[model samples]
Structure formats: C-alpha cells, structure tokens
Target: MSKVYSTQELIEILAQERRSCMNGQRLNLAASVSGNPVIDRFLKPEGIQKFSAYNDFKAAVHSYQRQHQVSGIIWCELTMKGKTLRYPAIDEQLAALDSDLKILKAAKADLLEFWYTGIQGMDLYLSINFGKDYQKIMPNDVKEVAQKTEWANLYEYKNYNFWEIILQLGWGKPEEASYKRGWPKSGSEYIHAVNPGKCPIC
Candidate 1:
C-alpha cells in the first residue's frame, strides 16, 4: 500500500531537502535520493524502505507511477534567489500583470500555483500549465508578464528569469511518459528539447 502525502507536506519535505543541498543551489527534488525520512512514506508497497541511491529512488517513483497509472508530482524549482519576486511579491506582481491582460479571467490559460519556499536564501516555485490554452496564451505572454512586472526588491538578475512554459508531458498518457533525466527543466532553463511533432503545444 502507498501512503498519500498532501501537497503542503510535499512542499515541506522539498524545503527540507533543499536546505540540505549545497546552500539550496543544487536542489533537484526529482533527482534527490531517498535519504529524507519522509520519502518512504510517500512510496507505495509501503513499509519503511531505504533506497541506496538517487537511481533507486527514481526507479521506485517510476514503478509506483507505472503501477498506479497516474502522473506523480513533479517539482520544478523556478528561482534560487528571487530577490524581488518571492511569495506575496510574486503573486502581487502576477496579479497586477493579469489584471492588464485578463489572462486568468479569460479562462483560457492556467498559471497553476506558486510557492515561496524560503531557504538559506530565497526560492520560488512557479508551476504553469499551458495545455489547453497554449493556442491563446502564447509563450511570449509569460515572458511579457515577467518583463512588465515590477520587482518589489532591488534585483540585478532580471535577464536570467525565463518561463518554463514551452512544453508539458502528455499527462493523458502517463503510462507511456518516461522519466527522462530532466523532463521539466528547472531554474530559468527554457525547455528547448521538445518534439514538435509529438508535442501538441510544442
């Protein structure tokens, strides 16, 4: 049997893992090992099991998804140090930008969720699902929003900010979706390796 962890619990676990990493700089949750006490709890065939390495942990996750036929939670770390755009600031700036474009109100696109996980520095988790509305909300729209938004704090790395809204896994077919080394690229890395012919939104 597998234990189900709530989204908040997962976030906390991810935060703890982030803090344990190299000053939260190389915190890749998907590629992380099962050293965290909480990892086994989220795994199926549930009994306290230890994965010796990240490959073991990854294999377990893939196995669980294959057995359940569902897409597992994918955490994409958006920014390591969101000097001006952390949590409420990011929400506020995005809200203001949305007000102008009426993007959310248009009922065409989804920004998904944003989480402000404060580590030794600062990190923000931004999840955007441009599935159905990929036609209406072009990738440029996200860049424009990020460009137009005002930073609450003084930040110098605005040029480094990029939206990971280019491609999404074919969620409808989770069974076939293989776990690549990095499917959803993280931290300002634009997804440039999508198959246009296979990807509906690519």
Candidate 2:
C-alpha cells in the first residue's frame, strides 16, 4: 500500500530528499522512489511544470519570504491520499512557471523540454547537463527553505527530469505500467491520455 502525506509532511520530505542530493548523493530516477506521496508526486512531470531560472526561483522565494513572512519557495498544491489535489484558482503567491523554460534557457542551461498539462499549464525541467564540473550551485533560498522546513513548511514542484521519470514509470495501463517499472503501485498510473490534471501518476 502507498503512504499518504499532509501538505506540510510532504514538503519536509521533499526538502530532505533535495538536501540529500545536494550533499552529493545521486538519485537514479529509474530505480528510486522515496515511498512518500508528496515527494513521489513532485518527482513526476507535472511538478516540474512550474519554474523560472534557478536564480529567479530563489529571488521569488526571497521576495515571498520577506513579504509573506515565509521562509522560501517550492511548488505547493493540495493533495488527498497519494494524488495531487488542486482547486480552480491561480495562486498569485506562487512563482509564475509559465515562462520558466525560456528563462532557464536564457541563463545558458542546456537540454530544455516541457510537457503540456491541460489548458496553458506547463513545467520546466532544466537538465543543466553541464555535469559536475559545471554543476549549478544550490540556491541559497532553496538551502534556506529546506533547512527551515519546520518553519517555512512550503514547497512546490517544477519540471526537471519529471518527464523522464514518467517515461521510466511507463504508461498505458496499471497492469503494464507498474510491472518492472519504477512506480511502486498500479493505482498510481495515469488513467487518462488526455485531460491529466496535476497528478499524472494518479
């Protein structure tokens, strides 16, 4: 069975995972599942849709931290059980991710791609394929946010290797999608080829 997470719980999990990666741990997308719903959800293509350049994302987080009295920025949405839950509204407090791919590109990162997610929604996943010699430094806001998860308790998903993780999880139906695939359960399969909402992995 899959574990569920409250919004706050999920954010902490994501922060932990990001910190682990930042500390020089490698995550093999094809074989890793943190076994936590929110972290797993953020691992998907949908989460990656929201973005700006890393620096821009950090700036937004800093601005939000000051004006809103929050610690930093991350993708945020409502979720019930292991599925992403969203209300029909635009969260202006959140960073605008619509132009993130372009912004990340302007920063000179390579390997830019985006996937469509209903209406005008899209996510950014900058590969930063420069390898370790050119690894981008983890933004201070991100470090600050993750460090203060208990206080900030906010995070958002943005596209980055999310699409690839989706591909690794396989597609079509639960039976095939879950077999020998990275996804741990069949119930998490995306049930629709179109009109997939925030949770593509169900």
Candidate 3:
C-alpha cells in the first residue's frame, strides 16, 4: 500500500524534489497540478492565471477569492537560484524584500518581475522589473528604500556587486519588455542602479 501524506507534507516533498531536480528553481505548484481533471474542473482558465511577479500573483489570488467566496491559503513557488547562503542570510533577504515589497505594492508600483539569479562560481544578484507606473515616485526615494531593503545579499564578502541592483522597465513582463538601464557608474566604478523603482518604464 502507498503511504498517505498530508497536504503540507506533499508540498514539502515537492519543494525538496524541485530544489534537487530543477537547479534550485522553486516548483510551480499550481502549474504542476494544471491539466489534472479534478483541478481543471474547478479552476478553469478564467479562474486562474500565471504571473511572473509576486505582487500581481497575490492581487489575482485575492481578487479570485473575493469573487468566488473561496477560502484557502495562497501559495506560489518563489524562484531562488544561486549559491546556498546560510539560513540566516537567506532569511534576511526575504525579510528585507518583504518590507520593501509592501511599500512598493502600496504605491501601486505594478511590479512585473522579481527574482534572483546566479549560482556557484557566479555573482548572485537580485532583480526587480516594474511597469510604467513606477515613474511617479521620486528616484532618490526609490534608491533609499531599496538599498536598505537588502537588495543583494547572496554572498558574505560584499563588494561592488553586493551594492548593485537592476531596475528594469517595460510592460507585460521583463522578457517581453523593451527597456532596461545598463549598469550605472558610481565615482569611477561601474555599478547597477540602487533600486528598480528609479528606472523609467517605457
């Protein structure tokens, strides 16, 4: 007989498998269950959508819940790729991003993409892509808030890359977007922007 697992247990199992098999990318639990007869029957295309950004995904989830009277936890697989840092190091970045995201969401920044990229022997970096609405905010304020939010904390021996942040601008999604700023130069050294909110969306 097969061993039964609780919902949380199954989620944990899937997450572990994704880390191992998918090069540290988080498992998209919803997409994983998509097309299953039972799931499709309940959550048809009209009831579910996919978004590359957490803010948009969250807003959609809440809207669906309110309209359908559904009651359940909202869950999504957050992508985290790069060298493994200590648990505290990871937690710190999460906490910082959470704080900053809340502020950005309230400002209606319309985030389009948020992710980390890099791996062992590579420079780990955090990136945020925003829609055109981001331009309403003051550039300096955007820089100040994001820098304090621990924008890049992948490695301990912090340096130029540690202070670097990419601010991408466009509509729909980052990949489909046509605007981005090259790395900025601070003093005499080349560095990326301090935060994405400062980027002008086209």
CA deviation > 4 Å runs, candidate 3: 1-14, 20-162, 173-191, 194-202
- Per-residue lDDT tens digits of candidate 3, residues 1-202? 6554433443344445434434423323354336679767776342232222232434444354344433322222223344332211111101112333333334323221232232112222223342323223334443454443312221222254343333332122111122332222101111133332233212
At residue 159, candidate 1 shows an lDDT of 27
Against the hidden reference, what TM-scores do the models get? 0.22, 0.17, 0.20
| lDDT at 102, model 1 | 34
Candidate 3: the clashing residue pairs are none
Best lDDT among the predictions, by candidate number: 3
Worst 10 residues of 2 by lDDT: 107-116
Candidate 2 C-alpha lDDT tens digits along 117-202: 22123221212222112122222322332232111111233354332111111112222222334243211211111122332321
> Which model, 1 or 2, shows the larger lDDT?
1
Off by over 4 Å in 2: 1-6, 25-186, 193-202
Ranking by lDDT: 3, 1, 2
* C-alpha lDDT of candidate 3 relative to the true structure: 0.31
